[model samples]
Target: MTRKTLLILLVSMHMIFGPHSFAQQRTQKPPLHAKHWMAITGKPLAATAGAMIFQKGGNAVDAACAMIAATCTMWDTLGWGGETQALIYNPHTRKVVGINALGVAPTGATPEFFRSKGMKYPPEYGPLAAVTPGTPGGILVMLAEFGKLSLKDVLEPAIQMADGYPIEAETANLIEREKERLKQWPYSRQVMLPHLGEKREAPEPGEIFRQPDLAATLRKLVEAEQEALKQGKSRKEAIYAAYDRFYKGDIAREIVRSVQEQGGLFTLEDLARWRVYIEEPVKTDYKGIEVYKLTTWVQGPVMLQTLNILENFDLRAMGYNSARYIHTLYQAMNLAFADRDFYYGDPYFPPAEPVRGLLSKEYARERAKLINMERNDPNIKPGDPYPFQGERNPYLKLLEKWGEQQKGAAKSDSQESARSNEEFEKDFYAGTTSVIAADEEGWVVSVTPSGGWIPAVIAGRTGIGLSQRMQSFVLDEAENPFNVVAPGKRPRATLTPSLALRDGEPYLAFAVQGGDSQDQNLLQFFLNIVEFGMTVQEATEAANFNSFQMRSSFGNHESRPGRILLNEAIPSWVRAELRKMGYEMTFAARTSGPINAILFDRKHGTMWGGSSNHGEDYGIAW
Candidate 1:
């Protein structure tokens, strides 16, 4: 055709399709491909830290440890005092192992203590919400057991960052926004408000924010390790020495003193007694792909249960993001989460969780039958999994009361009963950052480290922000007998990292941020790849919906039954159908993730890395 004719046709096409037509043709970011290794996390610099370790000839575990340390130091939705939960695929053993570094309630943190304070649930912030720090011990243990690099080698990037680094806009602005809360803690105010009394008391974007105290703290751990090595201790022993320094030495003393001084429940013994557990992860087979998640103490197993239930449905036939697909997934997630809120808790605690039964395939089929198919079930209660295990549910009466109370609450029409959308979204998303790393040696690590986010109370001169994870515990046993507040007991947490294997080989290592939404997003991410034929990058950027039917793990532990968050791209007809089905629909421009994932192409012997475009999440491959 002539140039004039082609121009006229292109102009006509542009007018017909609009500008979005071209924009929708490609992803905002490119996918990462690597033959040897790949590193992805919530922050770019943190991912660079992992790359630094990988370039130094360290394994995936070592690189992951570095990324975790760097992210913690940078306060990328977590801090030094935050908890760490990870799933690692050990190539040698060909097994997926769990790293449970979640902190426990400190001394005097019983439900009675909280109830006596006239609080319905634990405080959402401040020292009272603090738990014993666990990330330090978690890092050391993972390094000692599986990593090849020394503690000093793994921590160098974090130490340098702790000493001084250009604070990003997100964190700097967060400090500014939370200045009032930070001001409540003397140490936090002193550190976070570098320009105190100014309009913007927090550090400016791109300012070189230094944390000498945190740098010193990291140096102390390295010093302990070096001294142990000098004393002829093995590398593992030296690492343990550093762990002891943090949990049992001067660091512990400082942490306890700071917390107690601020009216927290932490004690010297609380720090000393906290330990990280390395255990076998729970797994389920969905269409021949084995998906794994951490056990009861976290909401990880909710995804597994959801999968077990979804296994009975042909989701691919429903079409992606169809009203039918969304409703099915939402109902399945609610059923699983209902069980999670009631039954999942610290397995080491006295009242054992009915986890064996909760994970049973037959039990899942039973739960799946509860879905109404055509509409939302706002009153979905925990299933009786105990009978599946040949045991009677001891908390049957409590479960009945819980269901009644939930049903009554759901019937509320009072204006005060409805939470503001902002408040609900805040608690729903909460805070956390995920780390994903994989190497040619067969090591794959997925971590969702959280707590001690912005507005966290800094623990004295240690520069450690205390964890606010105490908010996850229920003050009333009727709410969750297995997750009641008790001294030294782990609260049911939302942090969950995931892994998948095909025919006994590593297939996917992935995790995401957002409190209760973590599993919801992750479940869809998995399905996007496994069932919808999306690439790793496509899945990470896919538009997935969320259900807020289950009780919140943060704030007042409120549940907004039938509330659904949908991506804006969902058709109006789909929204209308969901609304007719009783869903209180909400929309957002992007809804899938900030999910970071690494898909192992075993056949090609390469890794395909994906990081969502929703946030500053990034990845590097080499």
Candidate 2:
């Protein structure tokens, strides 16, 4: 055929077959398909650990525990002393469960104490910023309650890694960058910077990095479990014995001594009193799908609240990533996050969070009515949710004061007052890593574990890095009454893992890294699949916008209203439209994620896995 004839033939075929009919949709990374199980997390090695567990006949919860342990050992944005928050879908109970393993402020970690130190919020790094360790207990409880394997079987990979593992370039580079801070802590300096006075003190990329202390510590837990088992203790009792070893035995003593030596506030009682709570998760329904998140302690509810407000609009009709859709989502997010900044906090604390009112559909409808369809509302303030739940707004005066502060902030948000782009983005997308696991047995688990990241202060001989979650607390009641620094109280954290159910069955389990932006990226990832009909891989790789309108949970807890981030693929016309809507736009080559997710393809009796191409997140399936 002649060239012109061939061209004409192709054009005719295009007209007949439609755009997507010609071939499978192209994605940066291929989606994983599995029949029996799937395991995904922030690191390749950690995902391998989960795969190993699955191959051993372990359930989803078992694999998740293994992956969490391995990631903590590798310092995949966290360490042994960090916090853990998870949402598990139990096949037996047929319900979503929340794992509240977040560390608490130690004794003497009060607002007055921090203010006396001449700080606005708690310090961002060092011993003073440490919270009591929580992950060890969290992992133990999950394994004891839901897993089918022994603690030794689950922790083998992590213990092996703790002995030594070839460090990835990303983590090695981060260590070098933060070496100055690492030097301040003797144990950290000894472990992270082996070369000492060399120009490049951190581990070389792919270098075998060993932590003998950490390996020994892990072995002690196993020893405790074995001792209990030999005594004819039940598996659950054996695991709790290990838990006690970490929290109240020799491990606890070392941790407390090291923390105090480094000028931290940890005490024996703080470690002994901290307990993991396996509570009922909170959920909201949208279009008959129930999405679950941890309660008010973490930022998970923000996504639910956003979904509630968005239920009032026809989001699919707006077209995906179009100016109108982005604008609408941004406005809804700002509104929800405004309530989050003010009201969402530790539910165990007094001046209890009006979560019932905040999550109410009626409150969402009222909040949605305030959205300006034509432009962004930078001055959006927290709505009064108390009345929606049959109560008066006790903090009305404080809310009014906050509103005035918001206006003043908007006015003064000039280039001079704004943080440097580098600094702003750093805190905006801080530490955390996600774990997603599912099995053919109808079990599913999603986890967002974080804290004790690079530049962490390693506690003396224990080799555990202290949690810096104290920075997430506000030092004054006026800033956030429920999140004020206080002993035994948990901070309002940014880590969130999400799960969705349809027709009383598992639909999706997803989570991502990015402080404060965790739910923002997750919301878009969900919409890309449900609203736009993208495959799991396509949804993860899709371009998504970010609104920096919420007060950051890190650093100075500042909010940059009207500032937004967009993927570079956005057309100039869309950018122009958003700018006209009063947005201060910034662009990135990739925006949506490093998200890791497992989609339960119930209709096909298979699992579909997605890991974003931007990071080292990986998955294995069988």
Candidate 3:
């Protein structure tokens, strides 16, 4: 056998014969490669689903759609009733596209509307936190534009799995943890915490956990497609029938009724008017590798911007995971994140901030110049991107208090305000799930589908739960115009996915599930490969750090100032050096998630895949 063939055979043998106890462990994984295709996801079942689709004559997009649907069904962190963002590279066209499916704020959801309710920020749970459903619409768009399978074909696995599948131990624990919260709503409790015998606790790890309601809901969409086909509609046209059923028909009506009855502002028009958009991706060349991300609407660009600044430094020379390397990494991230917090928003809206200027190499150099090597700086603010580009500033003040200028609704007691602030801080860190797939045809897709952490509220009997995406919006209208709650506006999302192209060919398709720590982790992952020359598994398994010094994208937008978080596995010497540099260091057992990635070496015509050992992340190359 050839050396590569022998390696694959040995790995397969080990997988089959090794102790099964370590199946749930991540640190034991070896780098796996295949000649044709690969898949990875937060859950093993999802990865299997994607591989099955690939074997059944599906392309990258088709496999991704199947994998996304399967992951949504199995993982509560990201369910079918949420939002998704994708970065796709079509090798045939040599074009990279950003598929943004972030739902819009309701037309009636205004600052005054919340002010009238005597609250500054929106509620974390209930109808007030929902936006129009986007996942179903996004699926249809992907199927129509790039997929080779019919809706029925791609969705069958997910629908069947939803009807009946064994719950993982980790997922069962999550259900138990959120049982009380899920019980707050009868519809949610019934759908999630179904009775198994006399008790209402979470099901055991290997027990079959079925969501008949969700299965029925998915079947209804499929039924719509079948009905359209019977009426002589084209396959594409039939797909739209399924889309209409979700957005413009009974599903939309059900969602609106549940929302409005609970004091929300959703209407049929808001649902009907919403549509997913496929736009060009924003990119920057890093060491001859072109990195791409979604524009300002989400935090994807933060990675691109940070990379631009780091490109100037010989990161390898600084030494991997060294105090100097780690310090420089955070300093670069702090600067990029500061700009992201101040300027990133929906580019479709008015008061244009410099998205282009922020990604410019010259701008990165200017921002990098501000970083000091001696001590950690906490007071760093947003820079003048427009000034660098020779344009006028969009706002009089870059940073504005969201509701400070607004009439303080009914002047609550100081204690009440303090409680409100504490509650806001508690709800910021939500959950997410991601998938990466590559096909023999050279099409690669990296998708981060999220928004189910607050699935405490169910939308009536549609078997479809809703999300708290509205919490992503800033109630303060003066902060960032692109992020303010407004009609037809996408909330500034922290769900970011990434794609890299080397020499104009698909190089890497990767994404992570760390709420606000996603971009920071991704920056480290990319460098671990490009700079440190680590294998895909080594890159993913390496210890990492995060700086909470900047404001988080989650609830309340709180900042930790100079606080830094590192893994306990990082060298103690590095940690001590960081402390010496004036950083308030905190240690965690581990930080990298559920990171799923696939890298293609076009020159050698081979693919390598890696999935983080943390949680249930799984990968397969064949």
Candidate 4:
């Protein structure tokens, strides 16, 4: 059908049948005719769920929604109940698509108000501070426009896991590591607590911690989705039910009551008025390959800028794991992060008069000039995209400072050397997972699921914890938005999903999960395929290093620090070179990002999916 015809038909059909009424929608089986598609994630269970749907003939979009639900259940790190954000590449329409499932700030909350009242930040991981959760909105929006599977079909795996399943070592470890916080909240205790608190701990590593409440939640969505489709509810209404159950109506009331009892500020209005922003995905050229990124609302766009700079140089010539590659990579990350700090912010609250120019071709090319190809500078400053002012209002805060030689006498901690301050700030970017799916029919999805940081921070009747995203914005009290406060309002997040295409054809479904490492890992994954031209497995296993200090919610909470936590994985030869260049770096214990990606080889007419070997998941098929 022509584009106009299709649009008209969709509108007329919805009107004729009523928005929720769907004779064809209800009785129609999800079209399961794709040649190939597979789900990839850290957990085999999530991968299996998507692969199962693909094996049974589901297309990429159908598989995308299903895999999301499955990952929520099986992956221990995913904030299944948290916000979601996604970027999609569409082959048929020759355009990039996006879904901003990130939640919005409450209407009444404001930064000045918070300052007037008391603290510089919100309550730690409190519900009063949450943005209306958006993952449910994300799922429903994707389904209304692209999904073919019934709600029940897509959610089956999650329901099973919530209702009954054997708990694994990983899940138990997560709970144990964050035990005190969970003990503080009633909901976490009730849902995650063992045997009505009598057991005093979550089920043992291999036992089960069933979630009957979550199961009931999923069941209600399935039934409501079906009925809405029949009664002709608007696509928006049909989608909103998922949101309503969580943020409005009975669920909202319960959530508000629970948090209110705890002295939280969240209310029904915040829940009822929530809306996910739908915007265009950002794009650029790296090594002649077209790279698409999400807006600065996420770190995805900034990552593309990093790749844009790195692509101008040939790192292969420097030798992998050589100090040259490590230094250059670290520099690239620092420059990109400087841009992120100065230029990237909620577009709703622009830093300097709305920087539509931040993502401009001129901007990236100009910033790329800041790199000193030969030597590293211990002293780093912000890059000013604006020429007239050339001002560096955005300073790189020292999150971790490396000791300079008292008299230019640089020192490296040898085998028996005592630990330094660098060693103390070191923490691995762990506890998160990802999912990806794509089919021959041209739909692709990448979701890096996370709720660990927030969900693990608090334990109570609200049943989850607050993500520390608020810390990033707290530094500049002046630029802080009205909703970012001493009391409530969700913080801008680091969890983002990415999609890429070649010649306007769906080419890759990808994700990376770590606090700030999310963007850093994605940049490398893209280069491994687009620049280095490596296969999925080769790209995943390739030894590499990430700059821990470049971008993250790690280490010092109040003051921003400048330190790079280099993975021990970097070869000694590379370390030697970086020292010669005057850059400060430290070794991290396995500080790697979990990457999951799927590729559609149009020339071969086949699709391949797999999790990074840096992780343990695999792509399975019939």
Candidate 5:
């Protein structure tokens, strides 16, 4: 992330509710070895390594398993033991099945759990904040059901990486940033604590660093699984034992003990009783294209809703990169995000708050009405449902002030407006990395791994910090319609992987891990391609903008003054036009998340894959 975004995040964290968030990211160029009928991810070296597993007869699923496993080693910025959400594109069925390998709130979880324990919502860094990790569980389940290779094959690269590598520019920076917090974990400091009694510097650009313990863990999984198989255990049994070793087994117990020492809440039972959530992925149709996203417990539906609102218009007619087009997108995002904040929550445990209705044509049409081709509604508020139905007036609400700001809508004065900027500046600090890939067998994968930031690394388990996802819950149980804090209820999330289909056939598998920025970029990128008919490369290269003041689930725009940030690449003329139309602007060419995408042009029978150069050069192999 650029300095501008980091500044914005500072304000958002303080004013947006919940607590401040930490970021973990890397910009290593992905290795160039996955172009030919193979699976790939964010890190070139890691993805290339996984693709090699594919060449060794591993299927696409096995390859993803390998990439994620390897990623846990080299990409320590993201937790070696965190959660993930996957979108599996199956060609034979021409249908997408969402494998929700996300972590769940503990059976003992509740909003008051933190409040009572004096543990703030964002529990700085500890087991109290950690949800059961889903990366290991999710990958294994996915591989066993869809992949043809064994666990050992999937885990090899990660094991090698953990054993050792030299520090690179990105990794070096991350370690330097977290050095203080990492001192507590022997394994963590052992790997990140620079050289022999000397400090480590940023690798010139692409350098390597190794983690022996992490390597040992990966090796343990493969070795134990291999032994289980030899012991006459069935594949399922062997896989289960492998998972146990990582979680309930020695490794997991060691982590649990360390967490307990740090006054954390992960119990032996919590680890033993933990289970992954399984739910149906959501589906929607926009611009004659069928789209699928994770269930509403995430931002994917809003992506669909935002697209639906844009579908009513021909973006090409608006002209590509025109100020008018940019303004239109901002308006659509503002409206869609309004619904997202109001209604989106864990369907399993919605807050008592009124149920927000999204994806309904009636709901979307009402949102589109707010868009004015000639004007910018900077003083934006959720408009009545577009294609307005006077009846079925569903009431959706969000916190406006500490007091009774919830009675209805409240207007902000010049003085109040000035304070909005101070409050929302915190949302800009997010940093993340993601990758997208597909193999010849008609399988596509996307992995956006983030958690365990640099500052307050986790107390134990190698200086890991739990993901800040717990922030998705509301303090007032009554405010959340479908988001009531509860045991096992997954928080509504922004990290959703997406798949786009042509004539109902899967053609695109893409994902970006930008937290709040994810929705904004996804909206612009998809609309630029679907409605405007631009290629994936063109869409990614085009300039993008986000309204920091725009109201959404993230909170009110009042937190920040009239601020809408744009990429430096956008022409001055366009910026001038937007300013004329009433948008306050900031500039940053680096804010656009590295959008990794694979476009299968069935019409041409070729795979055209490209990764953004905004922060990292993507790796493409064939």
Candidate 6:
């Protein structure tokens, strides 16, 4: 159908079925003949932007980049100054690529700096935790390397969206939740809150929200591209120039000035030297499907490890969301996370084992033996992931020393439950928005853009906010050598997004916005489709659970043992059985995911998409 005809048909449908009535029906039976592509995003407008890009003859990477930019605009918490990590599958090569756009700590940031201030850890909010912005670099690099569209073309939607957009109910609630923090800073208040004669208040839904300063910042990058173009640079070079402008030019200078002036750790050198690296993804095979995630720097490999361990059991036989199934899954995840706690860290650091060891089938088999279906394993410990048969391994001394250090550093068992409860109550949403796109050519991309929440102190007038990622670093330098704060080191992040391939073809692309619960949610979403035979929408809406027994990814890395939270939708009998089995149970108001997913069924030559309908998240298939 022509664009005009499609628009008319949509309008007519809305009129005939009533606004949103068609959407309800669409969820019940998602279209199987979306001719070109399908997309899901944290916001409806972002999905619309991706659809528009596809209509404009752009590819999946182009649509994904555009959707992410659009998401940053409508969801102010995740945009230019935030971090973006993506997993892209190129069908032609049948290979998946990973983007590590997560920011690194500045040279000026150190554990001693906070210690000198008489603190055990850095505050979760404000300048001390801020890292160099990574989204601009990630977006520009993706456009230059993998995309078919120019920077201007992909960024146009976000720039327009930044100028002004109607505030949705969820956005309004988010703003209200952060209003008190926003008021603490003048620039943040101006940008995020409603202005009424110099008094700031929470904005209502449907009110016009404007970010002229953010728009100007985005436009400035476009101007840099224009300048490079006029100077006879190719489109690709112009895109790089825009990146340079953000990191090495005026934008960097302003960020440095504001951050340093406000007593933060960021410097011009930090911005100038920062680079977003593209690396090989970590992969594992589960029931013939290959799952791909970004490397161990983030918590991506944990999913691979969890899947590997779960691969040993017949989850389908155990029954979906049954007590036995939940118990087995929880045990597997707990064991996997125990390894994650001790082994997962910056791969560049000392004693870092090859990522292959974490995903190895042999290692998974050994880890799977630790699970006990009848009872929860409260005293979990990391395993020897290294594959070796020698009587005495060379690294045994280091491992012993590491184990002793962790034992000394860890809090007593009696104090663990209280600390875990406090951590859960304080930090739930660790700042993220996700977007996924797929095209006719079978290219698929999943990007999780995060950070720059109101808790993150904004740089003055630059409309660029810093990331509080420094909190993810470890303060106990003696106990945690791999995750310690270091100059130019990327913190171990929780911003994991994933893509799956079936028989060497693109199958699914998905991600969620919760903090430590990301991998758990992704695993369930994957199973809900592949194991339960649910559509994308059904998979997303399926009941979800998370085991908070592992250490958090936020400040101080506090751990809680045997704490399992199940969605209210899970049967009451299952909860009762879990509690009887010694699992500390809590009924969550909702699941840990506002999961956004896209399923590409290459056999049927059809694409399916879904999003969390209860929130601002939306999806479009066409």
Model 1 CA lDDT for position 248: 94
What's each prediction's TM-score?
0.95, 0.96, 0.90, 0.81, 0.83, 0.90
lDDT of 2 by residue, 1-622 (tens): 9998897666544322222334686878889999999999999999999999999999999999999999999999998899999999998989899999999999999889988988878999999888999889999999999999999999999999989999999999999999999999999999999889999999999999999999999999999999999999999999999999999999999999999999999999999999999999899998888999999999999999999999999987777777888999999999999998889888887879998999999999999999999989878988999999999999988888997765554455443346787798898899999999999999899999998988898989999998999999987666677888889999999999999999999999999999998899999999888877777888898888899999889887778889999988676667888999999999999887889998888788999999998799999999
Point out where model 5 deviates above 4 Å: 1-38, 107-109, 116-120, 124-128, 184-187, 195-208, 350-356, 378-429, 456-465, 477-481, 550-561
Which lDDT tens digits does candidate 6 get at residues 418-473? 55564563564577888888888878899888877655566777777678777877
In model 2, state the lDDT of residue 107. Answer: 96
Best-to-worst lDDT order: 2, 1, 3, 6, 5, 4
TM-score of candidate 6 versus the correct structure, residues matched by position: 0.90
Q: What ordering of candidates by TM-score runs from best to worst?
A: 2, 1, 3, 6, 5, 4
User: lDDT of each prediction vs. the true structure?
Assistant: 0.90, 0.90, 0.78, 0.58, 0.62, 0.77
What is the clash count of model 1? 0
Please state the error at residue 511 of candidate 6 in Å.
Answer: 1.1
User: Lowest summed-lDDT stretch of 10 residues in model 6?
Assistant: 14-23
lDDT of 4 by residue, 381-465 (tens): 4454554244443422321121121111123222233544543333235335666777666677776655534244332333333
Better structure of 2 and 4 per TM-score: 2
Candidate 4 error regions (>4 Å)? 1-35, 55-57, 107-109, 112-120, 195-200, 230-240, 349-355, 386-431, 452-472, 478-490, 554-569, 588-592
lDDT, model 2: 0.90
Candidate 6 regions exceeding 4 Å error are 1-33, 194-200, 348-351, 388-426, 477-479
lDDT tens digits, residues 1-622, model 5?
Answer: 9998896655433222111122321223332233356444556677677668867887667777777666656553466656677787766766677777556666567767767875324343545555656677777777776777788777777776666665456666766765666676554565566453455532334555655566666677777788899999988778777778876887777767776685555666766666655556777777578888886677677688777787777776666556777787787887766566555676555432222346666677767877887777645554444224334434434333322432322254234344444345443334345656677777877666555444333435433334545555555533434655566666666677788887876667677766677878777777656655556655565456776543323322223324687877565567788888877887776655567677777766667665766654345456
Task: Report the Cα lDDT for candidate 3.
Answer: 0.78
